[model samples]
Structures are given as structure tokens and as C-alpha cells.
Target: MTRPRLLINFAITADGKTSTVRKDPAHFTSKADLHRLLEIRKRADAILVGRGTLEADEMSLTIPAEHEPAKQPLRCVVSRGGSFDPGHKIFRSKGGAVHLLATDPRPDYDPAVYEKSGATVHTGALPDFLHRLRTEYVVETLLCEGGGSLVRALADLDAIDEINLTFAGHTLFGGQDAPTITGALGEHLPRSLEFELVRFDPQDNGECFLTYERKR
Candidate 1:
């Protein structure tokens, strides 16, 4: 049951959609918000992103020297096939140990891609995989920068501890097909996970930053 403190961070449009139906990059949030993200990243022992997110944003997961984290936060990705472009920046980036969680085994899975890139691959169910993260990586805190489906999986498992969201004002990617912070719930049941709004800061612009903690 030893698990890292899981934190999910994302930005959405005024309409609550994380991205357009095309799943475009959400670069709409302010620069201040980007700095805020790095601040949070500096505190985490590892930063995780889903395969979809990785495909969308070739995230390097490197902490800036100004933040001065004792060491680089481990760069981690979650995917079933353990697939990544060998030339991806995460592999070429200096600092940060690269760790990949192959959450599912695939008939056509190729582990050599990750292994050749110097990434440690862990495989299994989400909950058990996270527990192993704490034991093996000493990951006391893990930050999730997402692509919705992974966040959905964590929420369904009731494993997330905190959510940090930035709502951008005056922007609307209004499409019923667009993605939100959580994608389609794998289960059909309607479940309400309760969270307390711990912080709410509205900026001069129409945007606001929000923090929520799961109710124990």
C-alpha cells in the first residue's frame, strides 16, 4: 500500500475542455502558470505522463537549474506497448533518470526500444506499479502531466490525491467531442469523487488557478 503522493496538473479552456477534438497542445495557459508547473515538478521525485501526452508533447521533463532540485526528477511515461521514438528528447536530455511503466503487455510489445534508450521499464497494474515506484525509485511524490485517459484511470482507481488545474479565461474549445481533464470513464457507472477546493486564485486576466485535494 506504499504509494507516492499522486498529483495531477492540467490546464483547460473556459469551457472545461483540455484540448480541441484534435487534441492540440494546450499552450493557452499563462507563462506564470508554466512556471507554477515547474515549481510543482521540482518538488516531485518523479514526473509521469501518459503515452498520448508524450506523443502530443515531446516532454523533456528537465528541471531548470534555477529551481535547483537536489537531483533531476525521474522522467516517467506510462504505456502498454513500451514504445517511444529512440530520438525523443527525453532520451537525449541530460539529468533525470528515465523510467517507463509499461502498464499492459501487448502481443506486439517491443521492450528493446525502451531498454536501448536507457529507460527502466516496469510493468503491471496501475496501483501495484505505483507501489513498486515508491519502493524501487523512492518516489515519495509523483506529478502527472496528462492526456486525460491516464488521469481517468487513476481517478477510477481512486488513487489520485490532488488536482491542480488552471482555467484559462476567454478561450473556448467548444466541442462535445473535445477532451476534458478526464476522458471516457472505462466503466459506465456514474461515480462522484469528492474533492475539497483548497486554493483558488483568480488572475487579472479571465483565468484562475485551482487546487483540490481528495476527501479522505
Candidate 2:
């Protein structure tokens, strides 16, 4: 099977927190970290995010000019409810193509609606969805910039090929029930999965940028 190589990248606090108690997106990404992230995105053929992330962050999800790939990667969203904002800047960007994967049974949405706005929407099962990404879209490497639930799902399915985590030394200590980067793994990760620390640099804001990779 020609499965796409999945790469999960995100920054977390020292206590393994991805966001702050106030739930502000700015708290999660620092300026230095953002530059590093864009560099990573430039190497991928597609970037994936969950619906909740799209709605909550109102992400534009574009690669920076200095790091832009020859062809812009496909922007993908895993939307179980089709609740993402069509007006988000990612859909408005003329830089790349956008693809939304929803489970909603409504065929009422005209692809042209998003197409006109600079995006394309598709719906299907997770595995089949990935297959389409690999075959139909010719995506060989997929980068997942996540909201925890999506990361957990992909990890549970054992679909992930690598994980690149940048641990920031800050904490989003309290919230009603905010998400974490890696949540509730039913069992210990397989012994086959081993992480090697690739880089450790200090950010201007007094946070550390740590990178890890899955040992194959």
C-alpha cells in the first residue's frame, strides 16, 4: 500500500501543554518557533489540521515567502461536522490549494463555493481520505499541525510515521478542559517507536525549541 508519510509537528510547554488557560493561539506559537514551523511546512506536500483548529484559530495556514515550496502544499482539514468557516484566510489565500474532508452527508455544498474562494472540499473515511491524498492528489508526505484530538486519532490508528515536537518551557496550567498535545494513549507506544532529539535551540522569549524524530 502506498501510504502517505505522516509528520506531526507542534510546540508544547514544559508540562506538555500546547495552549494556554486563556485559549489564545498566540500563546502557543512564538516568533522563532513560527519561523521554524514554516520551514518544516516548506518540505511537505500537504498540511493537515482538524476542524476545531480551523474554527478556533481562524488559521490562514500559508507558508512564508522565504520558505514556500515550488508548488504550494494542499491544505487539508479533517472536519467531521463541516463546521469550518469558509471565510477563513486559508481559503482566501491565492498561494495554495485547500481541501476539506468532512463526514457531513450533505451534498448541498457546491464545490464551486469554496473553489471560487480558493479551496476544494472532499468527504470520506479517514483511511480512504488518506488514500485519496496519496493517489489522487499525489501527496507523498503529509505534515499535521494539530489540535490534540486529531493527533490522538492518528496515533491510535498507527498511521503516523514521525513526530516532530518543539517543547516550549511555558505552561498553560489551567482551563475547564483544554486539550494536550498527546492525550490518553490507551497503551504504551510500541517499542518500535523511538524518538531521537534532533535540535535544541533557545528562543528569544526564553523558550527552548526541541525537535524529535521517530526512529525507523
Please report the candidate that would top lDDT against the real structure: 1
How does candidate 1 fare on TM-score? Answer: 0.93
lDDT of 2 by residue, 1-216 (tens): 466899888787666767655455644657777787888888889989987776668776777666646777888988776666667777766655788887663556555666677567787777888888999988999999988878887776678877776767665445535557654324554534566878777766757877776666
lDDT of each: 0.84, 0.74
**For every model shown, what is its TM-score relative to the native structure?**
0.93, 0.83
Q: What is the lDDT of residue 180 in candidate 1?
A: 82
What's the lDDT of the predicted structure labeled candidate 1?
Answer: 0.84
Off by over 4 Å in 2: 104-112, 116-118, 183-194, 201-205
List runs of model 1 lying over 4 Å from the truth: 184-190
Q: Considering summed lDDT, which 10 consecutive residues are worst modelled in model 1?
A: 183-192
List the pairs of residues colliding in candidate 2.
none
| Window of ten residues with lowest summed lDDT in model 2 | 183-192
